[model samples]
Target chain A: MKRKITLKQIAKELDVSISTVSKALRNSVEISEDTRLKVQAFAKLYNYRPNNIALSLKNRKSNTIGIIIPEIVHHFFSKVITGIELVANKRGYNVIVGLSNESFDKEVINMQMLANGSIDGFILSIAKETLQQQDYHHFKETINQGMPIVMFDRVINEIPCDKVIVDDVRGSRKAVEKLINNGCKTIGIITTKDYVSVGKLRTQGYLEALEDHKIEAESSLILKVDDKLLSENHLESLENEISNLFETNPKIDGIFAVNELYAVTAIKVARKFGLEIPKSLQVISFTDGVLSKHSMPSLTTVSQHGQKIGEKAADLLINRLEQEEAIEEGEEVFETVVIETELIERESTK
Target chain B: MKRKITLKQIAKELDVSISTVSKALRNSVEISEDTRLKVQAFAKLYNYRPNNIALSLKNRKSNTIGIIIPEIVHHFFSKVITGIELVANKRGYNVIVGLSNESFDKEVINMQMLANGSIDGFILSIAKETLQQQDYHHFKETINQGMPIVMFDRVINEIPCDKVIVDDVRGSRKAVEKLINNGCKTIGIITTKDYVSVGKLRTQGYLEALEDHKIEAESSLILKVDDKLLSENHLESLENEISNLFETNPKIDGIFAVNELYAVTAIKVARKFGLEIPKSLQVISFTDGVLSKHSMPSLTTVSQHGQKIGEKAADLLINRLEQEEAIEEGEEVFETVVIETELIERESTK
Candidate 1:
């Protein structure tokens, strides 16, 4: 029922450096007998067990980092990988990528496979299934075993580790505000179900923007698309759902989509209904990916700068891996770095 | 310089199983004295030196397969990875992906890094720079060191190994023939330079299609885009080049692009010239990726089935890895699998 205590926490409470605590716990002759006994007693009281994997860290140095992502076909995840590799390779570390296909079991299997002395650490994004199930034992177990993990983009707060994320709420708010600035009297927003962290944050931002503009948020104009619609087989149904939204709300003059697919789909459906883009229905979307750039009347978008996020995540992970010198153990500090997003203006907006 | 002989070749020449030849060469007591002498003499005659890494293979049983790719952001490569992971995970193997970023040095480094007891074998796509430089020493050296390799998509025939490829020439011919069947005259084909094997084959297919139709291939209508044009900073120049082709050959009614980017770019340029898709200017491209599907007119394309290629490549590599019962060394056979392509009709063409 209680949170697991770490070596850093024990060291901090004892007013000792992490290495001194480690040496004391290991009963190194370099540490005095009195200090060793005290450290061991403290460790036992807190049910602290030395990480199994950490004990072998000194013997195996692969100089390689493993990255496990939810999906390989995604534009944002790929960019993050490119960024991670650029930094990792330059720092004399090779990167090994594993795809979980958005499954919780696959995610756990990949982490375990990589952790078998093949990689020094990991940089990962949580899978949707894992998030939906609210299960993070795999992440906690890996960290407990002394392998550092730096999560990015799709991360859960339940795990105690470093994270790098974009300001999704702020980015979405800016997009909605831009639509309002374009003199749109009525607006619509399309997003994924609330289980997706980024989608939920973006949806909240949409509501906040409406409130700020004194425009009552219309529930009818907000569509929470089923994730299944994003797959290749259900594209027609996806179009139908978006089409139904437009047919039901004829006065919705502007749109904000949490991701590129929805934004492009809305454009296609709007054009089908004989609506002219920019002139009749301006739109803004998240993720400045290939779709946003290549879509006709190229989309105006909130660019997540995925590569930068990758770079930050890799830096956080590699720094932890190379921190041979034990920390001051001041509450075992963890960082959650937020990379700012940029609104890229294009032909889809006035 | 003479080519180094492999264990399979030695085994074949000695008329023994590959395992027997291996055991004999290692001076195992299980092999009869006569057989050991015969295998050893045959190996020495062919100047066979046991691969350094192969000797250590027995000590390391990391059930992970390493894959090195040219670019991770590419749609084709990503799909290939997805397929590979699906098959590998199912077969109780884990895939570790390494990106070469199309650099020859990075390719060599990634291979070397993985070969140091981190993985059982490698599945790789050769980097463009490696092919352009015509330096395959790294591949030859790796193979000589007794590690099995399975190359996919962009591969070199000089390396004696298993390969999985689409029928590029056939696929291209089909796409071009389809455009010709629609009564397109003065067709333009946008492609990469001849150094890229896929583009070169596709371009040859276009030429063959024109020859079959009794239409002399117009050199002016064929645009061999510089590889640099694909980068973000030079995309405008790429567009300009395509526009110039249209400007000079106003009567060109169809376009067969070797890849999705060129096909989509052509559509954008055609629209700029007030040409309507399908009705006035038909387009067909290779690679049924996101861009092809989501483009305004939805491109008609030759589906390469990248995932299938990945699956086949993984099967080939894993089989080699698990071939503990060495073959009856009659001959070391290698297979080049050609996965068929299908032309999917969409709005870009009639």
Candidate 2:
């Protein structure tokens, strides 16, 4: 087998120090441009490439960002990751992914494991349980150790770091207001994440929208479903819950489902109960998935642009890393970007 | 900030050479167990973590794997990723993802970018275009460079690497036989990926099932919907094609959709024509997404066990990596695991 060419071979041929050859390849200003070009030409001829590990060792930066997401099945997080990868790749960095499965302990352990110089920085969407428990010391310790972090989506406001978030409250409020303007009176809300900050904010928006229109917020109309019930046996509990929802409120004129799955279920359940969509119940939901665009009535949704969110978060982290000057040690709040939530009126809501 | 303790600090305090301290930390067999314990204890006390990049340089292993997926928004790929992350995390490996977006050029570029010592191995599910083109050179080069490759789901038969795949042929066959048993004489197969290997196999299965039931395979009943129409906002084209499908085969009593999204559309189109599910037109599909489980008259589908496929692929890759001796230079074909896809009797096909 032919031996692979090493940086030492280029150095030996050039009659220069190995460090000089390395510097030239890196296009370091310390090396003369003529010498750099000469070294680069020779390296190219021999197909000589410096070991990335060796380079990372000398620099103490891997040019890689670690991203931990709770789940990737959802369209919102998936687009966010695509956006992050797009920016990270363009900026000459790689992204490593860790799935927390929405476990707080797993999130902490992942952070601790990646903290040992595996990446230059971290861009994370905290798990649901992590936000609920308020256990953010692991993230705090990482920041304290001089590692930069940028949190997105399910983030804890308490942790002092750069944060890029969707204005969930505003988006929800806008959704509710739009439904109200379309003459939906008794708007019923379905949310699985009542404990998490984003979920709470969205619910708050629902209440605020109701108050803005002088409609009383009824506790009975607010449905709080847990993740366990959602995951167990293919929507058996969800079907039952939807059945009860209709049974309890035959007079309900509109529905606002917080997630795509719930919106789909609402559409299905409403259809089964002989409620004519748009005419009987105007449905508007959060987090558009494939189902929303293809359901029987072809759902109306508030599309959370996942790709844009991911891109913004990556840009923030990469920018911070590239900036040579030390940033002030405090929570840097990135304005919660409200990507326009276009109410996609389809057969269900038209 | 206080200077963090380094390897130099531990070595100086222990009166040991830096190399010996490093070796001891690695629990090298050359070092006595007493020295190992002492080094570990001191390292723990000082929180001395050997730089990850430095260790990678010495070992020539990144402990990071590159995962190239077609798209994350899809349920099968997302769930498979969840399973892969589960195993990869346990084994102390981090995965970096690259989206191929179902483009051959993108897949090739992703392979080229990761080939330069960025990852220890590559785990991929080939893009539809890649399969259609029958391209294997990009994959071949990675293997030649001694980088392990594991392909899953939409895999190539010729690629000499570890693979994880579900028996699409058998699954489709089973679905058809079940529909036939339900007393449906005329069946329509909806597929967008007629060029890929999996699509071909599944189509064959459908034909075989028809032949077994002594039903003629009618060319007109085989709806070859364009792949781009499935994902793109070309709803009009799809609606026209779906309308044409029903028109071509007015006696089409059952529909077997190759994917869940298409199946959901079939349900929608059928409803637009005022056809009742199961009683008038039975429907079944593959890759159980939320749409399948939650659609009105909830769909019956052939469940592709994504997590199991992921687990199998990871196990195969790790087994090869950990083998005491060098691997033989031919494709190690892990049996195409035929995870039995049961007929999920639901409201639609009941």
Candidate 3:
């Protein structure tokens, strides 16, 4: 069987990164001269074809939209896809999905595979590793090839493309303000590390709300948990971390978490400490997922309306595709539509 | 600005189902002669080309696997994808996903789009509508065209392909027997209608377990919920239905639900009735999802090992694809690999 060489294979054979091989193949300036030359020679030997999006887009229409999500077992992404499908079907286009699994190389690989004449445009969330590495070159290369992309949720500010995002900071601020108004004195926050854009923005909202109320911010009350420890299957670490937070901040009267799982887990841990919800500690989380709605005592939270974001993203991509000819002859304008978030009050709050 | 006409469009343009249009295109006698001729003529007029899978296979190897799932927002399906991706990545094959959204026409259209030289073979779970319609010409046609397929979870037995499934009957019987062993006198069951094969099998297991224990089965105790009434966002109907079950049978001491949502909801309703879990009432559900773990009082449920099913399905498909040359030269063998299920005890069961 004569299998075509892929960037992943080349990287494995030459003991380099997929990004390095991709850059070297494109003759990027960032790659070292020796590595680039070696990479080029190996690719040539294996007869590697990079699945050129530009050349493939020169003729024919697939009329399919490709969406790359960071993870598959996520509620928000699933809702977004449901929204995208409802609109795409009405607009006479089909949708396909690729998973990046939060890896930088996988993200690049999936984009290349989907862009290889399989789809007309893309709707994607930035992968965690790509954001951490601050690598936007693959995205720029695909757009340069004349394929339209609409990014949603986890988007980059510098990317010159249409984006649909929820007002993360404002939503978080609303949750914090609600807690303050309910007579919460010492509020604590459970959030992700600063690298994740949404988590960082949400943390900023908490800080801003505290400053507005003239409450002294305490570092001891803030718990920045590792995202890896937050998987639904193994939540012992998450529970232990929240337990430690309660142990250290005995005066904490309110809690704001970046997601529902953390908020629900905190409630479970709080029960061990014999603190009654709403009366002793009020809790709010971001993303109105199933956990918040189904958990005992429920939870007050922020609703991102993921489906609306997905619908808007599909419309933007399809509109851009239809206007490609006219846009080629005129100046291009990209829009960022912010989907407003709402706060839902439940038993966790006063 | 030209676009290829799809079966979905042909069906819409004419007043026929997508399945009818598909059959008419392939000259299946099942379609009425008048409808067949009209469909063929319309397809011809619009330059619609049914993706020729075998013809594409002769010239190239895309080395990509296409997986069509019934729904994306499901935990079991998501876990399966994670498992498939893990092994597929290790084995050097990439995966692309198409969603059917539980519709028959969308499943046909997605298969056509993916089969159009984008992927080498398919791994899919049948859509709900397709199962109800009982029109499996699409799978047969694809197989006849020299394309291999691997089915998982909700699969049909007649399809000559590799399959991965859990022992639904055995798993359900185990859950019921556990409840019985805990000294529950009168037991009830919550399941889907007979149209869904897994639900039917689980119900059968419940009945068999009752029969083996010399307990008379009561028709009043069986609550077959409409699948449409079970969406997470709108739980009022589901709650009402479960509440009715409890009201009708005040002496019910045990319950076995086919899925986690129903089991968790039953517990919630049981709480409303002031019945304590594991004492006055015991509950068990199938499919160990986050709800089973996170719900107050948790749940004792059947674990299908969805990731394991996915891994097995991928291995089967890749093995068959790699051995196509040998398979064609010699005898072909199809497999149905059954993944075993285990019961995880939690707060819901004593």
Candidate 4:
């Protein structure tokens, strides 16, 4: 769908910073008269619509921060929420949560419900359905109406806002490299469909590591799991798919799964195939969940530090909310923070 | 804290139901004029304050439900929240969550923040600290101010409102009975301090089960872990405590732990003592969490069915809220629903 040019785009065309374009469009006293007039003319030419940030800021502050997550029964999201709660409570701000359940409509409804004078700003992770649809009109409308949003984990590059994200590519690359250093020849990856940004990045990292070691990437060794298997009700199907991967590739020696459920399921399937873990089959997954620590042979994992991501996201949002209060209307600068992931080795890998 | 007599107390004194007293106090058309005068005179004599239900209901509806959980990183609570979200969304209501982190002060603050006209009703589980302190003024104030509350899991029996709770005593008794039937002698129990109502009831059930089976209840076999060990940061201390339990009672062949964390820790400690699971030692836990399902020797658990509990609580709260709308002022009737627990047999038990 065609959309109006954003402040970032207007600034890029006029060879100025986004802040300058914003000030010029709003006719701020800080902007030089010549640059202001030129920027305004260019913005008009492109039919740019100014964000009503000032109008939102004028509304009564709720002293509460809203967080919308994709799932509530997930450990990673839970840890992030705990971290946000800790920071929010300490800073005299209360935290409230909304679950999108990975639906685009729910995400939009949740945001509108909380943003309707219930919270000062938002700290959220994008829903999988939203990412897949590529429809960000609701998010755009909220931002345009002057409400600030700080996104974490799953974010859109096109949405100009503060974001905190894990280095998924580097994290998964390290997991694959660890398997390589342990002398595993046949490496397999169990991941989600490419629409999930993290899964896509992790898949990319697995390919890059194989390329770095001059190993040929084979389609037969990779399994893109259908998300329906994640419901835990269809864990049998997930196991069957993994079993198929092993059956098709008898030489499979190493595995990297994107999440805990997939990693543990892979282990169960490997054991059924009479393969001893860390001896014949080495495995690693990206998320450090409880299942990874307590599984039969345990699992090696890339720790995304969900708590740190939440803390950083909360800090960024609260800082912006407070800064806007102090400076009234100033230059709008957004920051994208990349949180480093760590590899935690356990019995799964040799 | 000294408090004003409630409608419940007046009803109890006058040998009438709580709803009758509530109706009479409000001088409702449904109540007989004589009964209304008698109830009103008694209320005046006792300095009773009528709940501001009408005033609260008169305000614009937020169409949002507020849920305050003691902890956010718990699997049971997470499942419960998922159930609440499922029902709330379908009923055209949005759900928001607040974490008290088991702190009384935080619980009060969360209630106050959400109660400030942000939500129509609340569904909460009591915090550990609030239970310890026995300070219920916050809850009383909210109820008095006329917002409906639905409580689940950890709830106060004294609080008169809708409640959905697992049959803790019966559930724990069944868990103990399972060990007895498994042909294991010298059964041990890992539980929490008695300040927590659930823990107290669970301990009582343990004693009752032993008595019913003609086995002597040994005080030495019971280990009440400090609440601090639940932080996960102090997991080492929890393991050490379980280790000491085994070292001092080497004859302990069976164990019933109140929660998944304690049960998993027991398994780890037993392994260190060179005891194989379900071979020499059998264990059963109350909560069926992720740890129980994925542990090396998967645990046998009495499932509390948290999601079912949440769904019930949501239905009860929403029903009352909607019912109130039909009748401008009506008799208030509260309910307590008990969700049954099921025993899931796994590798940990014979």
CA-RMSD of model 4: 18.1
- Candidate 1 local lDDT, residue A160: 90
DockQ of 3: 0.11
Q: How close is candidate 2 to the true structure, as a TM-score?
A: 0.90
RMSD of each: 16.1, 3.6, 17.5, 18.1
Q: Candidate 2 at A14: error in angstroms?
A: 9.9
Q: Write the per-residue lDDT of candidate 4 for residues B158-269, one digit (tens) a residue.
A: 9989999999999999999999998977999999998888888888888889999999988889999887435656778888888989988999999999999889888878
**Which residue pairs in candidate 1 collide?**
none
What order do you get sorting by TM-score, best first? 2, 1, 3, 4
What fraction of the real A-B contacts shows up in model 4? 0.36
Better candidate number, 1 or 3, judged by TM-score: 1
**Model 3, C-alpha of B87: deviation from truth (Å):** 3.3
lDDT of 4 by residue, A1-350 (tens): 12235788888888999899888877899999999999988877754553222222334565678899998788899999988988887786777778888989989888866665667789999998999899999887677656789999999889979999999999999999999999999999999989898999999999999999999999999899878324656777888889999999999999999999889888878888999999999999999988887666778999999999988988999998888778866768899999999999899998
Question: Which structure is stronger by DockQ: 1 or 4?
Answer: 1
For model 4, the stretches where C-alpha displacement exceeds 4 angstroms are A1-59, A229-233, A326-331, B1-60, B229-233, B325-331
Candidate 3 structure quality by residue, lDDT tens digits, A91-164:
96767777888889989988876665567889999988899899999898778767789999899999899999
Best by TM-score: 2
Cα-based lDDT for every prediction? 0.85, 0.80, 0.85, 0.85
TM-score for chain B of all predictions? 0.82, 0.89, 0.82, 0.82
Output the better candidate (3/4) by DockQ: 4
Give the DockQ (2 decimals) of all models. 0.16, 0.47, 0.11, 0.15
